[model samples]
Target: MIKAIQNIFSIPELRRRVLFTLCMLAVYRVGCHVPTPGVDAQVLAKFFEGTEGTLLGLVSAFTGGALERMTVFALGIMPYISASIILQLLAVVFEPVERLKNEGEQGRKVLTRWTRYGTIFLSIIQGTGIAIGLQTMRGPAGEFVVPDQGMGFILLTVITLTAGTAFIMWLGEQITERGIGNGISLIIFAGIVANMPAAIVNSVRLLRTGALTPLVGIAVLVLMIAVIMAIVFMERGQRRLPIHYAKRVVGMRNYGGQTSHLPLKVNMSGVIPPIFASSIIMFPATVANLVDVTWVQTLASMMTPDHWLYNVFFVALIIFFCYFYTAVTFNPVDVAENVKKQGGYIPGIRPGKPTADYIDIVLGRLTFAGAIYISAVCVLPTILIGEFGLPFYFGGTSLLIVVGVGMDTASQIEAHLISRSYEGFMKGVTLKGRHG
Candidate 1:
C-alpha cells in the first residue's frame, strides 16, 4: 500500500490533478466560513438549530452547515444542481433542446451554456426568497435573523449569493476540465466530509454522556462502516454484456472483427435518486412553513422524517426516479441500433429489436434492484435510528452521500494511477491491483 502511494506521486500528471482538486476543495471550505452581509451570524445559527426537522435542515446538511452559518456560500451548489435538473427535464419537453441534444458535441456545448444561465437565474430567485424568509425568522433568543429588512438588504443578498453560486459553478467547470473526477460531485463531497469532524465530536459527546451507551455507539460505528463498504462494492458493480462484431472487408484489408462488452452499472442512478427524492419531499415542507394554513402544516407533519408517510413517499420517489433518470440517460433502442450499424451483436440475441428488448429487460431488472438497494441503504438506517433511538450522525442519507462520493473519487484516482503505469493500492490488496 505504501509502495502504491509512492507510485501515485511518481506519476506527475496524476499527482498534479489530485493536488489541484484538493486545493479547489480547500477554497470551497474557506468560502463556507465567509458570512454574507445584513444577517446576524448568531441569530442565523440559532434559527438553524431550531429548524432541525424542517427543509432548512436538509439544505444545511447539503451545504455542510454553511446555510446555518449564513455564509456567502450558504446557498451552496444546490441552486446550481436544481437548475441543471430543471434544464435536463425541460430538454424532453422543449423541441430546441431535444434537437440540440441530438446534435452531438457542439449541441452539448450549447446545452451546457443554457444550464449555466439557468443556474445563475435560479441562484438569484432562491437567494431573494431566502433573504425574504430571513426577515421573518427569529432565533430561540428572540433575535431577528435580518435586523434591517428592506429592499436594500434583499437586493444585496440577491446579488451576493447569486454571484457566489455563479463563481462556484465556474470552479466546478474548471475542476472537471483541468482536474480529476467530477467537479460538482467533488464539491458536494467536500461539503459532506467537512461535517464529519463535527459529527464525530457530537457522537463522542453523546457516548460520554448517559444519553448513549458505549456498546451501542460502537455497534453503530461498526455498522455504519460496514454499510459504507457494501455501498462502495455495489456502486462499482456492473453487468457486462459481451458483443461480437463481424469481420468486414474494406478494400484489400479486413476490419471490424473484435469482441467487446457493454458495461451496465448496477447503480446507474448513483446518488441521484436519493438526492432527488429528498429534495422533492422537502420542498413541500419548505412551502408549508411559508403558508399559514392548517391543512398544509398537517400534511407536512405527516411527511416529516421518520414518519410512515414520509418513508413510503420517499421510497416511491426513489424508485420512480431510478427508472426516470435511467430512461433519460440510457436508451437501449438507440444502443441496439448503434450496435447493429457497427455490425455488432450481443451473444445469443438477434441484432435488431431483439437485442434492444433484451438490453431493456436487463436494465429494467437492474433498475428495480437499484431502487430497492438505494431505498434500503438510505431509508432503512433512518428507520432503525428512529425505531431504536440510534445516533443520528452515524446513519442514513448523509452517510450514504459521504460513502458513495468517497468511493467514486477513489475509483477515479485508481483509474488515473492505473492508466499512467502506476501501482494502485487495490493491486496489492486484491486481484485488481495496479500494474507498474
Candidate 2:
C-alpha cells in the first residue's frame, strides 16, 4: 500500500490531476466558511443543532456544515444534482430527449449542456426560496437568523448563492474532465469527510463527560464498523450471467469466439435511491419550516427522520427510485440488442427478446433486494440518533457517500496505476467498472 502511494506520484500526469483535485476541494472548503451577508452566524449555528431530522440537516451535511453556518456554499451541489435527475427523467418521457440518447456522444454533450442550463435555473429558484425563508427564520431564544429583512439582502443572497452554486458546478465539471473520479460525488464525499474530525472530537468529549455511556459508545463503534463492512460486501457483490459469442469468419481470419459475463450488481442504483428519496421526503419539511402555522409545524414534525411515517414513506420512495433510476440508466433491451448484433447470447437463453426478458427478470430481483439494503442502512442511523444521540455523520447516508465516493476515487487511482504497469494496492484486484 505504501509503495502504491509512491507509484501514484511517479506518474506526472496522475500526480498533477490528484493535486489539482485537492486544490479545487480546498477552494470549496474555503467557500464553505464565507458566510452569506445579513445572516447571524451564531444564531444560524444554534438553529441547525435541532435540525438533524430535517432536510435542512441533510443538506447541511452535504455542504460540510455550510448550511448551518449560512455560508455562500450553503446551497452546495444539490441544485446541479436535481437538474441532472430532472434531465434523466425527461429523457424517459420526452421524444426529443429519447432521440438524443440514441445520438451517442454528440447527443450526450447536448444533454449535458441542457443539464447545466437546468442547473442554473434550479439554483436560481432554490436560491430565491432560501433567501425568502431566511428572512423569516428564527433560532432558539427567539433570535432572528437574518437581521436585515429587505430587498437588498434578498437580492444579494440570491445572487451570492446562485453564483456560488454555479462556481461549484464548474469546479466539479473541471475535476471530472481534468482530474480523477466523478467530480460531483467527490465534492459531496469531501464535505462528509471534512466533518469527521469534529464528530470524532465531540464523541470523545461526550464519552469523557459521561454524556454518552462507555457501553453505548462502544456499541456505536461496533455498529459503525459492522455497517461499513456490510456496505463494502454488498457493493462488491454481483451476479454473473454467462455469455458466449459464436465463432465467426471475417475473410480468412476467425474472429468472434469469446466468452464473457454480464455482471449485475447487487445494488444497481448505488447510493442514488436513498439520495433521491431523502430529497423528496425532505422537501415538505423544508417548506413547512418557513411557515409559523400550526398545521405546517405538525406536518414538519411528522416528517422528521425518526417518525414512523417518515421512515415508511422514505423506504417506499427508496424502493421506487431503485427501480426508477435503474430503468433510466440501464436498459436490458438495449443490451440484448447490442449483444445480438455482435452474435452473442446468454447461455441457455435465446437471443433477442428472450435474452432481454431474462436480463430484466434478474435485474428486478436484484433491485428489490438492493432497495431493502439501502433502506435498512439509511434508517439505521435514524434509530441510533433518536435512541443514543449518535453523531449525524454516523448516519447511513453520510457513511454510504463517504464509502462509495472513496471506493470510486480509489478505483480511478487504481486504474491509473494499472495502466502505467505499476502494482496496485492489491494484486489481482480491480475496481468494478461503470456497468457493474
Candidate 3:
C-alpha cells in the first residue's frame, strides 16, 4: 500500500491530476464556510438542528452543512444535477433532443449549454423560496433566521447562491477535463466526507457525556465496518455473460476467434437511484413549507425521514429509478446489434432479435435484484439509527457514494498508470474503469 502511494507520485501526470483534484475539493470546502448575506448563522444553525427529518437535512448533508451555515454554497451542486437530469429525461421524450443526441459531441455541447441555463433558472427559483422561507422560520428558542427580509435581501441571496452554483459547475467541468474521475461525483463525495470528522466528534462527545454507551459505540463501529465490507463486495460484484466470437476468414487469414464476456455490474445504477430518489422527494417537502396549506403540511409531516410512508415511498422511488437508469444507460438492442456486427454471440442465444430478448431478460432480473439491494442498503441505516439507537454516522447512501466514487477515482488513476506500463495500487492486475 505504501509502495503504491509512492508509485502514484512517481508518475508525474497522475500525480498532477490527483493534486489538482485535491486543490479543487479544498476550494469547495472553503466556499462552504462563506455565509450568504442577510442570514443569522446562529439562528439558522439552531433551526436546522431540529430539521433532521426534513428535506433540508438531506440537502445540507450533500452540501457539507452549507445549508446549516447559510453559506454561499448552500444551494450546492443539486440545481446543476437536477438540470442535467431534466435534460436527459427530455432527450428521451423530446424529438428534437433525441435528434440532437445523435449529433455526437457538438450536440452534447448544445445540451450542456441548455443545462447551464436551466441550473441558473432553478437557482433563482429555489433561492427565492429559501429566502422567503428563512424569514418565516424561527429557531427552537424563538430566534428569527432572517432579521431583515425583503426584496433586496431576497435578490441578494438569489444572486449569491446562483453565482456559487455556477462557479461549482465550472469547477466540476474543469476537474473532469483536466483531472481524474467524474468531477460532479467528486464534488458531492467531498461534501459528504467533509461532515465525517464532525460526525465523529459528535459521536465521541456523546460517548463522553454518557448519552451513548460503550457497548452501543462498539456495536456501531462493528456494524459500520460490516456495512463497509458489504458495500465493497456489492459494488465490485458483477455477473459475466459469456460471448464467443466466431472464426472469420479475411484474405485467407483466420481472424475473429476470440473469447470475451460482458460484465453486468450488480449496482448498474450505482448511487444515482438513491440520489435521484432523495432529490425528487425533496420537492414535496419544499412545497409543503412554502405553501401554508393545512392538509399539505399534515401530509408533509407524515413524510419525514422517520415516518413509514416516507421510507416506503423512498424505497419505491429507488427501485423505479434503478430500472429507469439501467434502461437509459444500457440498450439491449444496440448491444445485440453491435455484437452481431462483430460476429459475436451468446453461446445459447441467436445473434439477432432473440439475443436482444435474452439480454433484456437477463438485465431485467439483474435490475430487480439491484433495486432491492440498493433500497435495503439505503434504508437499513435509518432503521438502525431510529430503532436500534445507533450513532449519527452510518454506512448507507453516503457510504455508498463515498466507496463507489473512491473506487472509481482510484481505478482511473490505475488506468493512467497501467496505460504508461507502470504498476499501480492493484499491482500488475488491471483495475476496471467506472463504466467497465
Candidate 4:
C-alpha cells in the first residue's frame, strides 16, 4: 500500500495531477467555512442542530456542514447536481437534447453548456428558497438565524450562493480537464471524507462518556470497514458477454474474425441512481419544511427518516432511478447494431433484433439484481442510523460512494502502474472482476 502511494507520485504527470486535485479540494474545503452575509453563524449552527432528522440534515451532510454554517458555499455543488439530473431526465423526452447526447464530442459540449445554464437557474431557485427559509428559521435557543430578514438579505444570499455554485461547477470541470480521477465524484467524495475525523471523535467521545460501549464502537468500526469492502467488490463487478466476429475478406489482407467480450457493469449506472433518488425524494420534504403548509408538513412527517413508508418509497424510487438511469445510459439497440455491423454475434443468437433482445434480457436480469443490492446496502444504513442512532457517516449511500470511488481511483492508478511494468497491489491475488 505504501509503495502504491509512492508509485503514484513517481510519475511526473501523475504527481502534478494529484497535486492539482488536492489543491482544488483544499480550496473547496476552505470555501465551505466562509460565511455568507447577514447570517448569524452561531445561530445557524444551533438551528441545524435542532433540525437533525430533517431533510436539511441530509443536505448538510452532502455539503460537509456548509449549509449549517451558512457559508458562501452553503449551497455547495448540490444545485449543479440537481440541474444535471434534471437535464439527464429531460434528455429522455427532449429530442434536441437526445440528439446532442448521441452527436459525439460537439453534442456533449452543447449539452454540457445547457446543463451549466440549468445549474444557474436551479441555484437561483434553491438559494432563494433557502434564504427565505433562513429568515424565518430560529435556533434551538430561540435566536434568529438571519438578522436582516428582508428582501436585501434574500437577494444577497441568492447572489452569493448562486455564484458560489457556478464557481464550484467551474472548479470541477477544471479538475476533470487537468487533474486525476473524476472531478465531480472527487468533490463529493472529499466532502464525505472530510467529516470522517469529526465523526470518529464524536463516536469516541460517546464511548468515553458511557453513551456508547467500547465493544459496540469497535463493532461499528469493523462493520464500516466490512461494508466498504463489500461496496468495493460490488462496484467493480461486471457481466461479460462473449461475441464472435465472422471472418470477412478484404481487398488484399484478411482483417475480420476475432472473439471479444462486451462488459456490462453489475451496477451499470454506478452511484448515480441512489444520489438522484435521495435528492428527488428529499426535495419535497425540503420545500414542505420551508413553506410551512399543513399538508406539506404532514407529508414531510410521514417521510421522516425511519418510517416504513419512507423506506418503502425510498427503495422504490431507488429501483426506478436505477432502471431509469441505466436505460438512458445504455442502449441495447445501439450495441446490437454496432456489433452486427462489425459482423459480431453471440454464439447461439441471431444478429440484429434478436441480439438486441437477448442483450436486453440479460441486462434486465442483471439490473434487477443490481437494484436489489443497491437498495439493501443504501436502505440498511439509513434504517440502522435512524433507528439505532448510529453515526450518519456509517450510512449506506455514503459508504457506497466512498468505497466505489476508492476502488475506481485505485483501479485507475493500478492500470497506470501496471502499464509501466510495475506489479500491481493485487498481482498475487486472483483479482477477478466482481460479477463477471
TM-score of each model, in listed order: 0.92, 0.92, 0.91, 0.91
Q: Candidate 4's residue-wise lDDT over 1-436, tens digit each?
A: 7776777788787789889989999999999989998988887776666566566876787788888888888888887777887777777789887888889999999888988998999999989888888888877767788877889998999999999899889889988899877788888888888878998889888988999887778788888778777776777788999999999888887876899999988888777778767876776677774576888888888877777888898899889988988998788999999999898999999999999999999999889888988998888777778798876467667778877777777777677666665556774643333342
List per-prediction Cα lDDT, in the order shown: 0.83, 0.88, 0.86, 0.82
User: What is the C-alpha lDDT profile of model 1 across 72-112, one tens digit per residue?
Assistant: 88889998888787777777778888899889999999989
- Model 4 stretches astray by more than 4 angstroms: 283-288, 291-298, 386-392, 427-436
TM-score, cand. 2:
0.92
lDDT of 4 at 51: 62
Residues 1-436, candidate 2: write the lDDT tens digits. Answer: 7787788899999999999999999999999999898899888877777776568988998899888898889899999998988877888889999899789999999999998999889988988988988877788789898887899988999999999999999999999999999899989998999889998999999989988888888888998898999998889889999989999998999987899999999999988888878988887787776667888788888888778898999999999999999998899999999999989999899999999999999999999999999999999878777765676447678888888888889989988977777778885665443443
TM-score between candidate 4 and the true structure = 0.91
Candidate 4 worst ten-residue window by lDDT: 427-436
The lDDT leader among the candidates is: 2
